[model samples]
Target: MKNLIIIGARGFGREVYDLAKQCSGYNTEYIIKGFLDDKSDALDGFENYPEIISSVEEYKIEENDVFVCALGSIKWKIYYTELILSNGAKFMNLIHPSTILNTNAVVGVGLIVFMNSNISNDCIIGDFVTIQGYVGLGHDTRIDKWSHLSAYSFTGGFVVLEEKVLLNTRATILPHVTVRKGATVGASSLVIKNVKEGTTVFGIPAKILNF
Candidate 1:
């Protein structure tokens, strides 16, 4: 059985562990070696079979071991994923059994898809992307590298979110809209138009909040 390690031990990390357990091909025979978290000593009484390996810098990566970032934030996920990849650690893509991914969808490496997420036909999700629970991505939507789709967020058909974009919980992007790199959409905002790079938008019809 191959050994797997989780990089974060927080809420998202724990959730990833549970989801991995349901993937019979990976977890039924694979061994969950442990987790690597800075706060490992602080999380008492946690019942998953992962012991804290070490801090990110202290842990050693073996070629045979698989690692999952399990981070919800785009910044952290990208940073850690790059660090791990640079160190020659293998990154694993985790998709929950409850999530529905269309046959034509193309998912890149190091992605995490949580429960009840629906990815429609021809969608393209890039590396290190995180899709939280209850999110619905419409057909042909393109999510670039390191982007995060928070819980309950919705994207219309052909919407494009560039690298490092963050869509907060319940946010909605209309069809053909483009969110540029490093842009953030505030919770529940309705994105109807193109968002400039590095900007933050909020409210209905998503006006630019941080220029």
Candidate 2:
């Protein structure tokens, strides 16, 4: 079993640590080797495990070490992922044991699928994507790299979320709706139409916001 190191050392990082334990509960495949945070100050604490190690930037990569970028932002996801990859650090997909990934779904590396998230058949989940708990992706959905689906978000079949898109909590995308790159669907918004790149929408039948 490889030793796991979770990057980003914040709330999401700790969450990933707990989720990794859940993955091991059903199948003991990896042993957690504490966390490697970006800030040296973040090494000050952790509710579980003893090792704080060092900031990911200065830490030396080892052959036995595997990483999971627990960063919540797409920009950081790409940045940190590239940082680790360039340094010869390998990443592993951390899918919770309770999550349901269909047989026909295609998931890229460094993906994080939390508990209760369901990826239906024919879906394509890109690299470094974060599917939060209670999220559901219908069949044929395509989630591009560094995108995030927050808890309770639901997407209909054939929906597409481009790179760095954010589907906030409980957001619903109707069938065939495409959320372009870097857009955000506000919490509880109902997206019946396509969302343009870099726009932020909110409310029922989501409308683009000025902010």
Candidate 3:
């Protein structure tokens, strides 16, 4: 059986643990080993979870070991994931059993999709993407690498989320809208037009936020 190691031991790491338990073949095909974090006491207050084994930098990859990243920061997620990749570590996609994924969708490696999320037909989810609970991805949607869709976020058909885009809770993207790379959509915002790269947009119509 393969041993799974979760990267990071913070809030999102704990949540990923809960999701992993509910995934298919929890203990049959693979079992969780422990967390990999620099902070040794990252899981000190947590109960029933395996302690942090070793930091990602120090941990040696075993023959039957696989990894999944649970870090919340997109920048750090990329950094740590790439670091582990350089060490010849393999990653597993942690998809919740309750998630609705269409058969026609194309998904890359290391995707973390939470429960109750719906990915419609013909969608493409890139590597290391995170889709939070209750997020709705419409048909033909394309979400690039390192993009994060927060809880309750919804997108209409043909929406494109470029690399490193962040959609906060309850954000809605209209049909055919393209959120450029490194853009942030605020919570409860409605995106009608294309969001510029590296900008933050908020409000009802989702105008650019300057600060």
Task: Choose the strongest candidate by lDDT.
Answer: 3
lDDT of 3 by residue, 16-127 (tens): 9988899996899899999999999988877999889999999999999999999989999999999999999999998898898897999999999999999999999999
What Cα-based lDDT does every candidate model obtain?
0.87, 0.88, 0.95
RMSD of each: 1.7, 1.6, 0.7
TM-score of each: 0.93, 0.94, 0.98
The sequence of per-residue lDDT tens digits that candidate 2 reaches over residues 63-170 is 678889998887888887898899898889989878998979999989898998899999999988999999999999999989989999999999999999999999
Model 2: worst 10 consecutive residues (lDDT sum): 43-52
Mark the 10 consecutive residues where model 3 has the least summed lDDT: 42-51
The pairs that clash in candidate 2 are none
Ranking by TM-score: 3, 2, 1
Query: Of the pair 1 and 3, which is ahead by TM-score?
Result: 3
Per-residue lDDT tens digits of candidate 1, residues 90-196?
Answer: 87777878899897999998888888999999999998888888999999999999998999999999999999999999999999999999999999999999999
Q: At residue 182, what lDDT does model 1 achieve?
A: 96
For all candidates, the clash counts are: 0, 0, 0
